[model samples]
Target chain A: DQQVKQNSPSLSVQEGRISILNCDYTNSMFDYFLWYKKYPAEGPTFLISISSIKDKNEDGRFTVFLNKSAKHLSLHIVPSQPGDSAVYFCAACLYNTDKLIFGTGTRLQVFP
Target chain B: GAGVSQSPSNKVTEKGKDVELRCDPISGHTALYWYRQRLGQGLEFLIYFQGNSAPDKSGLPSDRFSAERTGESVSTLTIQRTQQEDSAVYLCASSPPGIGNQPQHFGDGTRLSIL
Candidate 1:
């Protein structure tokens, strides 16, 4: 079963605009959520994360919002840059385990 | 700081041949995991190791897949008598111990192709 899903396969946005990526999960036991960015032939890099107790977390230009009641989360990147072009993956950690369930990933392209 | 490292960035082997993939997690990380992504598919968990506890093999697709971690360090995943269906990018990740909420650092995965 696909416990976590990123419905959009690709997203395009102009530089300096806001880029939003959405993720959904079917599991209620997942308490921690994270976002990762990946380039071609490289591993994913940790971006931002939020715990079930928190609704929002921000780091500089990136922000993550979690809606626990709906089991949905989103990553927002403001003033998107060409360097932000890459595959973005959303992952959820089981409530009490180190295992992570990852979404299929959304490819984001920021163009000048 | 250094990140997780994996070897044999690309491997092409004939069916029925055996292959082993290696992962060297960041120093001092206590949790390690193996995942595979086939073409057009999301990441699928294969196994996990935490501290000195017994490894979790629940995610192994079949008997041909097995993994071993020496303590909290390097890990090796062996596929015995590989088949064409086993082709995929095998990714390794590591996180800190006990705190399940930590983000996992992944390695540049090994791309395995079976012909």
Candidate 2:
């Protein structure tokens, strides 16, 4: 079973526009969530993360919102740039656990 | 290397042949993990090793799949009598020792193709 799900397979947005990606989880035990961005041949790199206790976390142009009640979280990239185009995977893990459950990933295309 | 290192970036072997993939995690990292990503699919957890603790092998899909890590260093994942379905990108990741929430640093991954 897929504990973490990213329903959107792909997304497209114009440069300098807002891009939002969504993810949902089935397990409430997951207390920490993270987002990773990946290019075609490289491994995924960490982007942003948020604890379940907080509703939002922001870093520069990227922001993550968490809603514990709905078991949902989202990553928002404001003023998206061409460099931001990549596959985004949402991951979640339980407190003290070493394994991270990952979503299928959503490919975001930011065009000029 | 500054990042996790995986050897033999691409492998193409005939079916039924055994293949071994290797990973070198970042120095000083104590947590290592293995994952597989098939075309059009997300990363699937395969195994994990933390310090001297027993490895978690629950995610291994079959008895033909096995992995070994020596003293928090290099790891090897071996697949015996590979099948076409086994073809995919196998990724290795390492994380600093922590209770949780540490983002894993991953290698580019070893792409295996069973023909």
Candidate 3:
């Protein structure tokens, strides 16, 4: 059973535009959500994260918005650049079980 | 390396063979984790180790899979009599000691292919 799901397999956007990636989860027990970016042959790197209590968390160009009632969350990268082209994975974790439950991931291509 | 490191970036072995994948986590990090991503799939958790405590092996798929950590440093994942379905990129990660809320730092991973 897939606890987390990223519906979009891929996305393309022009540079300097805003790129949005969405993720949904079935488990309501998850208290923390995180986004990771991955390049070819490299493991995922931590991007941004949001706690369940808050609706949104932002760090520089990346922002994560969570909707607890809907069991969904999204990552928005503003002013998207070519360097932002990579696979984005959404992961959820219960505080008690720190192990991450990751989604299938969305590959974003930022074109110049 | 300043970040988590994994060795043998790529491994190709015949079916029924045994393979060992190694991981060296960041300095002073007390938490280590192992995850694998199969073709076109999400990262799957395999195991977790924290300090001197017992490791969590709940995510391990079968008895053929096992992992060992020496002290709080290097860890090895051993797959016995590997099967074709075992081909994937095995990733290792580490985090500072404390609440599980902290994000983990990952290595480049070891890609294992069973021929």
Candidate 4:
């Protein structure tokens, strides 16, 4: 069973535009959500995260918005650059579980 | 301060062979994790280790898959008699103690291919 799901397999956007990636979760117990960006042959790098207590969190050009009632969250990258082209993975973790459940990931391509 | 490191970036072996993948976590990090990503799939949790405590191996696929950690620094994942289905990129991650809410730092991962 996929606890977390990223419906979009891929996305393309022009440079300097806003890029949005969405994710959904089946487990309401998850209290923390995170986004990671990965390049080819490289490990995923931490991007942004949001706690259940907060509905939104922003880090520089990256912003994460969470909707608890809908069991959904999204990552928005403003002024997307060519370097922003990578796979974005959404992950969730419950309070007690030390492991994080990851989604299938969305491949983002930014055209310069 | 270096990040997590994984060795043997790529390994190709015939079916029924055994392969060992290694990982070195960040300095002083007490938590380590292992995950597998099959092509065109999501990351699947395999195991977790926390400073001198028993590991959580609930996600291990089968008995043929096992792991070991030396202290809080290094870890090794061993796949015995590997099958074609075992081919995937094995990733390792680490975090500091009391930082479960924080994001994990990942290694480049070891890509294993069973031919």
DockQ of predicted candidate 3: 0.92
Model 4 misplaced regions, further than 4 Å? none
lDDT of all predictions: 0.93, 0.96, 0.96, 0.95
Whole-structure CA lDDT of model 3: 0.96
Clashing pairs in 4: none
Worst ten-residue run, lDDT, model 1 chain A?
Answer: A93-102
Candidate 3 wrongly placed segments (more than 4 Å): none
Off by over 4 Å in 2: none
Q: TM-score of every model?
A: 0.97, 0.98, 0.98, 0.98
RMSD of 2: 0.8
Q: Model 4 over residues A1-112: C-alpha lDDT tens digits?
A: 8999999999999999999999999999999999999998999999999999999999999999999999999999999999999999999998777789999999999998
Better of 1 and 4 by DockQ: 4
Instruction: For residues B1-115, write the lDDT of model 4, one tens digit per residue.
Output: 4999999999999999999999999998899999999999989999999899999999999999999999998899999999999999999999987844868999999999999
lDDT of 2 by residue, B1-115 (tens): 6999998999999999999999999999999999999999999999999999999998999999999999989999999999999999999999998764788999999999999
In candidate 1, residue B62 scores what lDDT?
A: 98
True contacts kept of each: 0.72, 0.80, 0.88, 0.90
